[model samples]
Target: MNITLVLFLIVVGITLVITGWAARRTRTTVQFWAAGRGIKGWQNGLAIAGDYMSAASFLGIAGLIAFNGYDGFMYSVGWLVAYLTVLFLIAEPMRNTGKYTLADVLSYRMSPIPVRSAAAFSTVAVSASYMMAQMIGAGSLIKILIPSLDTTLKPWFNWTILGTKLDPSITLVGVLMMIYVIAGGMVATTWVQIVKAVMLMGGAILLSFLVLLHFGFNLGGFFNAIAGVKDSKTGLNFTQPGILYTYGKTQVWGVDKALLENVSLGMALILGTAGLPHILMRFFTVPDAKAARQSVAWAMGLIGSFYIMTTFLGFGAATLVGKSNICATVAPKCTPNSNLAAPRLAEYLGNSFFGTGGGEFLLAFIAAVAFATILAVVAGLTLAASGAFSHDFYVNVIRTHLLHGHVSEREQVLVARITAALVGLLSIWLAARVGATANAAALVAGVAFVIASAANLPAILFTLFWKRFNTWGAVASLVGGSLVTIWLVAIGPGWSAPRPGWAPNRSLRRDPVSTRGERPAPLPYIFLVSQRDLVGLIALDVACLLAAAMMLRAWRRRRTRPPLVAAIFVVVLAAVATVLVLLGVTYSLVVGPTFIVALLVIMYTARYERRVTQR
Candidate 1:
């Protein structure tokens, strides 16, 4: 039997055993969703680290650094720093207040049903996008290990599956993911994450060590090699910061579009981790506020160390394997794939150190580890999605509104298991239908991060700390932010423009960055809203500041009825402005005004509640 096949079976068998054992104890809602809150801080911390470091961190970031160089390392920086937001602002407060999902926190002071519905929708959306990216990476990695399997199955299952031919590897990955979540629930999922985290950290550490050994453990030599690395096609050193982010022939206020895009990506990443439903859900599995805080502390250390090692994983591939081999300039030659960089590098390093046939063993181990990474992440995402639906939507919304107000523990657990299976199936269909290319997994996951940051972050912060935040503000932030973020992504340069020579399929929609003959397409100006007159931009910013002043004044005199109607008028004005801005207007207008309006609405609602109480 092939080494990769043997390792794959071993990995699958161990996880299944864990699932079987966990299923025995998973008899109630708490066990199914929160692991009965018996998990120790270190255990949940490892799980959080495992859940957070998905295929995007392992495969996608490594490939990005291999190809894009320094620009790719920004992802590592942003993601590592993001845990601060969680530690100081979100983690303890969330555990102290909420039960299962992010909706638990938001629905604390607001109307339960509508707020829960909005939150559930956003959770599902983020999870679906994030899950699709992980599944695609898994399928692509699997295809590499067992290329013959896909070809063998293609003859019988050759019909179009979501417009692209079905690959057996994708189906296989999806089936295993469903099994993990359906059988073991959070208990099984938590242990699987703990196991995978150890495997991944070990693999990463070994790879980094070998890379250092190749350079004779000299930091200067390694840095020099990376600096002198050449682009496969253009021969430019991609190790420079601005290389990949360059926008084509487009400037905003004479500023490079690349800079703006970089900033935008950074903001999304830094804020997104605090808002991720899967990461937030991990907090509930621990006992209390102190456990939650300890877990975050442990996670930050583990996550930081892993991200630091990614520098070695990425640059090692670039210098040792060469970019041309990782992503060939010519068609189909050199095995032309970026997603396989880390595994391929493992093969090379093993051969160099241990001689003939050792490459296969190392490659097999890394491949199994990569598969475990994907499975662990997908399980967490599916659980979070199901929890949102079964707990928030079904129990809180549907049961409260239509069915009887009370729901039994057994019924909720059953509903959650059913929902997990359905969500897994839907994700499989979407991943197969889109046929997302493997190398683009990080960017694909970026879509989820952006949505989470825009929609969930604001709502979470307000609910936890802001005293005046109410149902209307919660609904607006969740629904409005999600819709606007999705719209912006749809029209952005990434999705709207394609490289000149590529086919016009939706699969190739992202602005192509090829080492081949094509250059990136020009960005649409409407998407580059910074090009609006500089004076007008400053004026709108000033107006935003004035709006802040008004909010401060309203806060000081909140008890009086005189400014109550005026606060309502400001909210109405802000709403009208938001409508106009959303209609073919500059994007900057959206952020400042929308935030101001949400605050104003909170103020008005708080005053109204006070008046009603007095009457």
Candidate 2:
């Protein structure tokens, strides 16, 4: 077998062995669902890291940094800090009250049927979005890791799937994820995550150290070198944030609008972590609330270090390896797609550090780690989605309709396994149909996070803190928020950027380069060419509107101008902002929903308290 495939098999084989071991121990429902709460603090922490740090963190960010520079690190900082939200607001409470899944916490006091069904919908939506990113990334990375797959499979494996071209590795992922979760349950999923996490961390640290050692450990020198030269791909300054925020450097309106897009995406990242079903579920894997708390701390350390190291990898590839070479060698999936940066960097380092064979070994190793990263993450997502399906939907909602009594232990386990397999299969089919892009991971993850921030986070927060948050509010938050996010994503720039003649000049990349310099610039790249900003606005507004309505209805149907006023203001403002974005008038996707969500929350809750006391 080829080295890449061999390494891939080794990683999969080891995980499958773990799955067998875990299956034997996974007899009881609790064991199948949460590993019987027997996981140690460190082990669970590593698993969390593994789940959080996917291809997005390892490959996507490094490629982003290699090309986009400072704006790329925003993902790093936002994700690490987001853990604080989880630790303080979510982790302990979730562990304290929750059982198998996050929906348990939502269903704790509310009617289990509607609340859990809504929660299940939100979980599946988020998991599907997140899983899509990893799926497309796994498919695209094969071009570089195993070029033959791209050449041979794309031609002969031309059997179209879901109307998209096929790749063998991409198809294989669906099978692997299904088997891992269905066969082993939480024990297998946790161990897989832990193994991938450890390998990922080791690989990142080693790569970072080698990059530093190449520059004689001089931090200043490394910074100077990165800043001194423009990016080889697009010739932009290497330390600017405009790559994510600016239109082509020449368009004043598009350039300014980029800021709003950045804020919108950042907001999602900051809030989404607390609501991620896979992440929140990890708390139950630990023994107690304290270990759950401790695990976040450990995760923050490891994740922060990994993100920091990614900058070095990005700049290292841009500087030493040359973007031209990477694009040439890993083409149709390099530079702009940027997921190839880490692998290319590893290969470069291997050549620099050892010689010819060195690159082959290093490339094989990194390919395995990245492949393992996708598998472990997909397994976690599948577990969360399927857990919600079985525990919340089947047992809590659907089972009650068909059966007279509670769902049995064996029934729950059987349903969960079946649901997980279905989820894995669906994700593979959906992921296979997706085309490759530079921000594949970011695009998918961003949608999932924004949806969580909009739909799940508010419900979770209100359920925990707002004593008066009723079933209506929780249900509205989940359903209304998810619908809005999904609709916005469907219409947003990300999905709609290719309207035949939107720009007509060719590609619509989001690079921050300008023609003011001696070198000519390419076509104008917009901040939200992928339209994350539009999704953010809709998410924030939906969250506010649903939350406010919940309070208004709960208060004896009393008329309130505040909700109406806020809605009018938001609608008017959103129309104006959307117009500006479409006409290239402004980039203020950041303005419409900024204070509205917070304002609605404070107003509604306070009003509820006053009305209750007076009544």
Candidate 3:
């Protein structure tokens, strides 16, 4: 048997056993959703660390560091510091005020229907976006780890199902995640995270140690290697900050486009965590606010240590494995986008220390751990999204309006399980549509963080801290912020780029007619949103929404026919503009901000006009 397959089987077997055990205990809503709140501080903390580390941290960040050098490490810095927001602002308060989901807290001081409805929409959006990244990473990792499937056994594994050719790796990952959540629930998911976290940490620590050992344990030598590193293709030094973020000579408001992009990414990384539904859901697994706080403390320590150690994994791969070896157009080691850098580095170290056979074993071991990381994180994400839809929207909003009474716990749990399965299937289909060359870290930060920051963070902060915040503001923030962010992403670089097989041949570039083989770029917003153009977009939308809200309020007392008419016109223009934007008739950068602006205008129009009429 292949070492990779064997190790993968071992990990799968262990997790399956865990799921079977957990399913028995997952009979009640409390058990299925919160593990009966029986988790201790240390255990919950480990699970948080596991959930947070994810494939993005282990595989994506390491690959980023290997390829981009110093700039790539910024991801680690942003993620590490993000916990402070959770520790001080969210964890304890969320535990105290909410029962199952973030909507529970938002609905506390506001109208439950609209607030829960909007919250559920944002939660599913963020979770699905985040889970897509993990699935992408998993697919890429599996392709490289089991290279034989690409050549020797391709036909057997890769086959068409219902006219859609199935990517064996993606299908396998999706099925496993659904089984974990639909069967085991939170009890199974938590233990899987704990196990995966320990394994990931162990793999990372060992890899870092070997890299240090290569330098004879000289810290000075390691830093020197990083500073002197250079990319073979671009010939750029690895110690700089502009490689990835400043590709063009574009300037924004007198500052380097690089600087603006970095700041935007940093903002999302820092604030997005406090609003992540999966991370916030972890707080409920603990017994109380005190335990939630303790879990955050433990998570910070573990997460801080793991991110710091990423320095070694990234720099080591860059210096030792070499960029050419990690990514190439030829055979033997044909990894794409440096997604397999960490595993490739493990193989190199293992070969050096334990020979070729030993190298293969270590590679398989680390790959298995990476696979486990994806499985755990995706399961958690599915659960969170399902909980939001089933508990918050279906039960709280739909059932309240229709049934007009309480739902049985058994029925709620059943609905949640069914939702988890459906969510997993949809996520798998969507992730499979993404090209294999996509960067996992970039995908996560660009799509997930942007949505979380734009949609959830503002509402969460206002709900917890602002004195005058109400249902209208929360609803506007969630609905408006999510729509604007999604719009900006749809028209941004990735999805708007020319479709596959559209590139002009080098020999035909001089003659326009000779390049008939090249295809034009897709219509803007025709495809799904991508993982770029986040930094400035988030700030722009947030500022526009808040400014519109404040400015519209000044005319509260002057609510006459003219203002209402203007509101109606703007809303109509926004609707038309949205359709035009999708059809490539207009650009989102011009029309995206107006989404929130129009929403807030209408909101103010309705509220103050009604009050004036009452008087």
Candidate 4:
């Protein structure tokens, strides 16, 4: 009966109808998986933008800017700049070689058995993590918009059930997106993404204009408003330390005036962008290497412009909305979470459209757009993972039965749908479980970056240029990087401690404190040593360096000999990683020891390569 619900249902209905129409023509596996590889360059480029700009960019980045300030911009900068590297390096070659997915390119030379299996496993892991983040974001947006909705509703709006009270809007999005992706595959997904991108860009442009208009179209006036606000009690100016430092107890740039954390995050963004399964796979949807290159160029322009607009939105939120309004609207708790910052700002500027009585229609419309954002992103993620499963895993590996007997395209489409549903369910369960813990979005995003950087990046880069690159070496790097990243996160300092009364100790144990006459000593030794920090650094260093070394060794061993391109790529990778590590160590001793160790490993790898070449 409500206007908000009505608007949402209409959108969902339209999306479902379109999806059904698109799917009616599916006649082959290629058509189902890659949209018959007939997608236009510009069209796929827009879709890539949609896939890249998720709730994280719209909600998370703005929240970061609203809360943290400069560090938040650093996140945006890191992400956008990464695309420049992708445009120059990875895009064209990937499209030229692969038929459908990253697995297709990486495993083209290897036997379908283990190579396809590894690629599929990695794709599923990366895609699942990314999807869960989108789903959680959807749930959070729903909770905010439909504050009156019950915990559950079944079979066309019935009664409340178990589970947290979800926004009916999120459920609406989930069902609609699932239907669209399941029915039409890439065709429906691409068009939906394109439409959503246009809407999102338009919304952002309007919001920015409105904010600027509030300041009489004066940029200086807006900044002046932000600079003027200083809390009397805290005695700190809002814009002084930048946003991130002001929001968190910890400094944004880093401790001891270092940029280690920033550099680490930056490296992750730069190298990781090229390796993302969903983004890389988009290149395959286009016609040729040239198209793939052009697509990247277009993506950079769109993404960059969008991010610049987001900066204005963030600063506008901080200046116009104020901290109190943001805290109340986004997160009621005093805890600093950047995810709600942008939405809070929107509600503030559009207050006449929200809160207590007037703009209910407008509020619902914005909420619907936010809901669409999550749905589009999640659908893309599901399609990417499911395509890997159906094409790379099932069709490629379980080939004998299907190859000998004629298999119907309908059956293949059915298999993909089943895989999508299975992946969606698994991600939802994982997200629900993880949501109980703190900072679920950040953790998931971090995992995605680490997987892309460690597992896929090395293999992808090597395959393109390295003549000696063998299948075994690529496999080693993929498995090695993935497992190591997982281990580091599990045991690293970032790991959250168990809640009180949940653990046997009933309190967080920070190593085991050594006492000096009832007062704590300077250091607490665990396992007779202070090994926690050392162990983590060493593990990360080895994981990155060893993987690089493995790839180099493989490159040197090929009978065909190394090409100029391959040699240049190896050197460039070495230089970038080394420079980043050194920059990271400049701030904290925590990374220095690790950097030295990594350097030593690199030197040894170089020496080994030389010996292999001579032999």
Which one wins on lDDT? 3
Candidate 2 C-alpha lDDT tens digits along 264-283: 77788899888889998999
The whole-model lDDT of each prediction reads 0.81, 0.78, 0.81, 0.68
What TM-score quantifies how close candidate 2 is to the native fold? Answer: 0.80
Instruction: Report clash pairs, candidate 3.
Output: none
Number of backbone collisions per candidate: 0, 6, 0, 7
Task: Show model 3 residue runs off by greater than 4 Å.
Answer: 148-163, 231-236, 246-249, 328-336, 439-441, 499-591, 603-615
lDDT of 3 by residue, 1-615 (tens): 688888888999999999999999998899998999999999999999988898877877888899889888998999989999999899998999889899998999998988999999999989988888888767776787766534544565576645566667877888999999999999999999999999999999999999999999999988888878876545678887667776556565556677888898899899888889999999999999899999999999999999888878988999998777886344676646577789889999999988899899998999899889999999999999999999999988989865798899899999999999999988877777664546433654577888888889899889999989999899998988788888887655445345332223334224222332253454534453332333333444455445444545545656456464544556455555555444533354655666566666666666666666789
Candidate 4 residues lying further than 4 Å off, grouped into runs, are 148-173, 230-258, 328-337, 352-359, 400-410, 436-438, 494-496, 499-615
lDDT of 4 by residue, 523-602 (tens): 33222333554465446556655655555566656643333234444445545554443333211233433344444444
lDDT of 4 at 388: 84
1-615, model 1: which lDDT tens digit per residue? 677777878999999999999999899999999999999999999999999998778877888899888888998999899999999999999998988899998998887877899999999888888898888877777777655555655676555655666657777777777888888899999999999999999999999999999999999999899988976544458567755776554466667678888898889988999989999999999999999999998999999999999989999999898777774233565656767779878988999999969888888889889989988999999999999999999988899766757888989989999999999878887778767575355556888998899999999999988899888778788877777777666545445346442434647553333322242233433343444544454455456456645755765665655455555555556555544453435444365555555555555555565665689
Which consecutive 10 residues in model 4 have the weakest lDDT in total?
511-520
When sorted by lDDT, best at the front, the candidate numbers are 3, 1, 2, 4
Stretches > 4 Å off in candidate 1: 148-166, 231-239, 247-250, 327-332, 496-615
Clashes in model 4: which pairs?
A: 63-338, 68-243, 68-244, 69-243, 69-244, 151-165, 353-359
Roughly what TM-score does model 4 have, to 2 decimal places? Answer: 0.76
Which candidate achieves the best TM-score against the true structure?
A: 3
lDDT of 2 at 121: 92
Give lDDT for model 2.
0.78
